[model samples]
Target chain A: MSHDTVVTAAMLAIGDELLSGRTKDKNIGHLAELLTLSGIDLKEVRIVADDEEAIVEALNALRARYDYVFTSGGIGPTHDDITADAIAKAFGLPCDHDETAMTLLAEMYRRREMEFTEARQRMARMPRGAAHIANPVSTAPGFIIGNVYVMAGVPQVFQAMIDNVLPMLRTGTPVLSLAIACPYGEGDIGTPLAAIQKAHPDTSIGSYPRYIDQKFSTEIVVRGRAQAAIDAAGAEVHAMIGAIRRKKEVVENPSAEA
Target chain B: MSHDTVVTAAMLAIGDELLSGRTKDKNIGHLAELLTLSGIDLKEVRIVADDEEAIVEALNALRARYDYVFTSGGIGPTHDDITADAIAKAFGLPCDHDETAMTLLAEMYRRREMEFTEARQRMARMPRGAAHIANPVSTAPGFIIGNVYVMAGVPQVFQAMIDNVLPMLRTGTPVLSLAIACPYGEGDIGTPLAAIQKAHPDTSIGSYPRYIDQKFSTEIVVRGRAQAAIDAAGAEVHAMIGAIRRKKEVVENPSAEA
Candidate 1:
């Protein structure tokens, strides 16, 4: 079957703090979930250092491969925040102060009555021929140059910008998922699960084991775009699990009636 | 100031589920932290699909560039789990049953009195010249071929294997950090923080803003290997904040007692 209809996106998280273990990158999970719900498939995620070369390489590769690329971090007022410059270099464009971005920066400083220094004005730099992404919480707006969308690295500000930006993008058919969990090991149900996948070729069966309260249990998650097929596959899984549970009960207490 | 005595590492997460937004790859954070604690700098992280060609390409590039390369996932009993095969292809070695890995797998199945099928036996395959990595949680052991370490995809199992394997490798001096959060806006502290970073070229200072109860507060984090430098930098940061707070109090009660 042709899977050409799926809209794919990639995430790039740039910072040394994440690599140094000083900060945990939380944007990956939040963006992945947001894209999934919007029917956009996240195809790849890369975390690179604050260095210019690393960011440029990742940005070029992902932008060429995926339909859309979203990047977080290195967009603040500090000298180390070089995401805007890196994106410009990757796309072969000049990094300069855009009037649109400068307007927003000036408005924010004017409201606070703070003297905006040249260091603070550094936030207004954007790649040539790009649009600004609105930041509802903070004013240092993220910008989109071609397929690469660069935003602030901080989780709260990044999330707010995503919420404002995602609605403007095109989406594909959304994926649906069905799940079942019981006290069972994956090996005992592997054969039946494989058979279900073969019958419903469009669906994917994922087996995840959860350890809760020091007890092991497995959750069988089935995902597809078709609802009827999902129900049919889910029914087969339940029957197979019921059979195994009954057989175990019979062996444990031979005299007990079911 | 030659900072060239640093051991660097990169993590490659191989799984389509992570890319497809079905699973959040937790191993990257855990590995990043573990590597940093071991004094090995985690420089980059990449998450790709289970495709052999992609895995092989990433394996070659990262292994050639970094001091150490760690890969998680795509090493399992299913048809798509081809990490061992890909590593063999990257190294131009034959993929076959490793004697040590086979012994460990056999002992594990024997303890539980379970029959090891051909599918389960697939876990024993490794590169021709690779060595086995100890898996404390399960029998499907990880392997180390050259600079690359191939481990399980599951979080708990991979973490246990890392703890067992990392001590055997050489490490560098670990990094240290100090941070303080105050009720101040980033706009108020932006200039002074920039000055602190400029004054101390060896220390890296980061500013993070959080919105709590609809008010913005910023956290200033400073990091360095030297204790004396960090103490001096932290004192300057506090002094700056004290000055800002005092100004705010004076502006609020201008006609009160001096």
Candidate 2:
């Protein structure tokens, strides 16, 4: 896509468990991968504790800066689930139990013969004018309010919300990424790779280093919106890797020429 | 720990791979858990793309707000690896090849019979007046400048750097945590849990819900610095869960009196 056609997004992950290291976040990666596939650039991500003020501040900052701000966590039925209220205050809207959400919860509870207690009812609350994002995994729906998508912290629920939300949002031209593996490590290829990157300013080349079986290996990923740009960069990186491999082989056996 | 004695930290993860979901971040979880165990509250985490301006802005913001700011990624031999340069700019310091780091790299490369090319030499560069965080997994070193720590993106290197850096930082009182398992889900226990939390404001109670075997379950964690406060809040939460379980059992089987 053209630079102006780029659709950018930011994610805010809200939970004390995540900040405390009690819960390893799975949603950020899930959301990021999906967004990238759908042609939205996940520009930034912020993980904050379940404090209301922090949520409000992050929500406001991210919502204003990106095309969409997707938040995971803090929408549960428990007391610590303050995301809905925080989003409400951030947008200067009243958060209350929405009749649509309340009805959804009520029906789900009745089918299971569970009481729709006040705690459960809290899940039905969202910022005013918010649209519901259906949760196929769970009964309580996530809400979309003014470009901010507030979803559950549970990995399954978060992914489900993304499934619902992705189809409805505006997406850019998908980013094309090609990965080339090289036996050479970063130290062996950094200079040539940088030159190739300089030659292809329109593409982004990333060098990922790995230690495998006591040998250093690297993966070169060339990403761009246009296929022609990606193909050009990828071919150059592959050729560079081959050249480095041959050079290293000749250095190891100087008598080969003789 | 008392409020005044609390030591707080923040983490900045710099890499396009992370934002692109090409890399699932392992450093954030490892750092968060270790910091929490070390009596440092990891208050926030930010993941930014490999953009120098983004890194500089996040570094300045986090370094000023928290006692310590830990960063992972972008300190590599490749061109995309610009974290050290960005950090230098953020702190208004000159970044150049450190004599100690260069010496270390030179000696290691010589011993391994590998060329210390310009690309390899790039790893030796760091911000002026920065202290080295040794990477045992790799020869390259991370650096600490002011309250900001710049580390590698690789998981093994990042963990090794943490092992070297954690011992030197100030810490708060270790937070005490107690978890109680409950068969009932959050909806069944949210109200009473809130009451228990309010009754012991000094402690933090977190409700983590799970769906297993098509049934709802939850784990309640009570955390505080004082053992007494944790025990007090924990006891209340335990008692409430038991009460809810008993009530639900009776409600489901009304013929039990026979």
Candidate 3:
């Protein structure tokens, strides 16, 4: 798998609860992980409030920029749920209840002996010429309009929808990564790390700092589609870390913590 | 303080680690909660990879739309830390090492008997004519340029910077909320709930469903700055729930779950 063959994606999270801090978004990370496993690159994520204009603007921007745009929340049976209408406006299409979605909801309600009200039926609405994304948790189905796949906010339901939708989309080459951790601050290794990154332009190297057991440590990860590139980059980073450790022994007095 | 005086903010979380799903974001939720307590409305959040163009685009858009734009990540001492350069480009200002920030970092390093390298000094760079946001966790100081505040990616450092910067900004009237949970699905109450929302247009009502105890339940929350409006809307919701319960008893067979 080559770097040029990578498929790209973007996610739009729609809800006032998310923007207001009432809800900590779990779907974005979940989708990012799922997309990675499916060989899709998640390029960007935007969380906008439950405003029609905001939703429409973000949806259009992401759909145009990426191969796929996944949206979560704002598809419920509430008054504030306006994702379907907003997505419709983004594509210049009319949004209405789908027969398949409505039938599924009706049957589920009938089994539970609950009345399928207008609000519940609202979940059936989607942009014209959209394909339905099956929901195994609840009968309310999500839909795919253009490149955007609208999903529920609930964690369980969203994951279920992803499981159903993943097989329907095309996957690309999976990204591979190698991580090397050393008990040193980022500043101690930043210079050489940059050189290693420059040497391996195809692979992206990230330095993440962690404080564990009252000791500063850094984890450097090299990621790329090419195994040889990743291996070369990883070896350089490992050598760099070893040199930095030897330099610390010669320059600074060794403390028990160090 | 009134509805018209509400202060709004947006957040831009920049990192490849986040977009790759290697790190679950902790700063957005923390900042959202902190801003809410300080009477600031967090209206939007955008997460982008470690790309300069993406950061500049999002920074410009969010800064223009909201009263304040808060950015987290990419302010580290690593090569991928390009946020400062991107922010400077966005504001059409030159990015240089701030004297105050550099002085602080130098003193901290000197005390620890460590040399202040160029990579470490990279944290001192900011858009020209920007004020510094102190980082108590680490010596690397964040900065405020125009309405956008650039902070560290590390959660501890980001939170400390927020603590230092929040007092310098203006806050609005605190928003209040009231929540009531009922064992009825959103569909069962959507019709009357819409009427309640219409009656109190100033307040926002959100319906969140939960699957608990093998039965479906809904939590309706009304939020606004006005207590009287919240009470009025809340009373209507409570009354509607009671009416729906009575109607359910007459229409369907009683069940232990209901």
Candidate 4:
């Protein structure tokens, strides 16, 4: 409820598939970008296997440290889907079939004329005293217990659940960033850029190098909680890059300099 | 250099850009796939900011827990490039510019007719007694200290570093995987699949649900250390899927059953 202070969160991506490299995780990036834009700082991310002990250990550690913890994967109908059980273990709660969830799922299946099979009923399981995070894309639901929000591994379902959870949490001041293109690489601007970063301690300046068209170039991105700080640091970076370009041109061409 | 036992690994992705959503990391997946295929179990992955303390703490934790710890990012020419410092601190050793790295990088710049600038010189810094991981894409080499492999964050450079490091380390038996496509979703086969999983304790069975073409589908992936176990689980999974399909067809088309 409080937006005055930073809302820090961590992601626990639980799945053997992720660790085994069977699934190239897309949820981490998607959730990261959303959290950044929403002003919630995603401070850390931990990817662990589907083993319940592994999930419980990671979940407990993360939930205690960060304001909110988001977990994806392992809440489906299969036996391997033990995230719900893990969450309960982490919070010292009981995980069992919830009447509300079962009723909703049953109604949806009945409308579609599909039987609510025993395995499908597994989807109704949730941590005691947890609220359901709607998965609009699918009939099954993801739940929130304590600070942890359990979501599906499927990208579409995870994304939909993310949308449902984002509105309920607290957010901090959105970060403002400005990027300056430097025709030169980090080697060319690192010194001057470090000076600018030190001069504006409020701004965090980063130099990213790219090799394009057989030449190396860098992009200096200045980020800060406030606009003025980012602009101040960004201006210095732009001027520094301009000076380097001119100096290089002059050194390469003595006649042009004269 | 022992390939008899399972080699475990953890990746520490260091960068504020990754946390800020400015850069979506491709290194994690790339390295994960490579490690998996190399018979190394990438057990866990941690993404932290470029902060020195964060890097040092994560590096320490990972290096101690896993057989090998692979770190990507924050090893460059900029002031934010503090991975080398962190690695050195974690190992309780001095981090200084190495003569070998300096010589190699210096010659690389000289060959290209570029100045060996002070910022570029930062790339030569490494933990005392660390071995350089060759970067063919860019002459700026990554260093390996103890069991930890420090690599460039750029996908191309990270990949090149991975190739250099893989052959040097020991690996376990390659994991064999079999994926069976099930037209029905998890709800239809989750119970039977769980039974098959219980029957085959050696194999790890995973049910992945997909929302495709406005219908639910699932893929059951069976993974194991040996072919016989994978084959045994694979056969049961196939047979189970076939039986489900036949039963569903009979129920949907009563006239066809006659």
Residue-level lDDT tens digits of model 4 in B1-258: 133468899999999988877888988888888888988999999999998888888888889999999999998899999999988999999999999999999999999888888989999999999999999988889988889999999888889889998899888888889988888988889889999999999888998888887788988999888899899999999999889878888888987687
TM-score of chain B of each: 0.94, 0.97, 0.93, 0.96
How close to the true structure is residue B206 of candidate 1, measured as C-alpha lDDT?
Answer: 79
Choose the strongest candidate by TM-score.
2
Worst 10 residues of 3 chain B by lDDT: B249-258
CA lDDT scores, all candidates in order: 0.82, 0.91, 0.88, 0.88
What would the C-alpha RMSD of candidate 1 be, to one decimal place?
3.1
> TM-score of each candidate?
0.89, 0.98, 0.95, 0.97
Clashing pairs in 1: none
Q: Which stretches of candidate 1 lie over 4 Å from their true place?
A: A1-4, A190-200, A213-216, A228-258, B246-258
After TM-score superposition, the amount by which residue B201's alpha carbon in candidate 3 deviates from its true location, in angstroms, is 0.7
Model 4 DockQ, alpha carbons vs. true complex: 0.78
Candidate 2 vs candidate 4: the TM-score winner is: 2
Candidate 2 residue lDDT tens string, A1-258: 346378999999999999888999999999899999988999999999989999999889999999999999989899999999999999999999999999989999999999998899999999889999999888899999999998999888888888999989999988889999888889999999999999999999999999876678899999998999999999899899888877877899977646
The TM-score between candidate 1 and the true structure equals 0.89
Residue pair clashes in candidate 4? none
* Candidate 1 residue lDDT tens string, B143-197: 9999999998888888888988898777976766788886886767777778888
RMSD of 2: 1.3
Candidate 1's displacement at residue B35, Å, is: 1.8
Give per-residue lDDT, candidate 3, residue A24.
90
Q: DockQ, per-model, please?
A: 0.45, 0.85, 0.72, 0.78
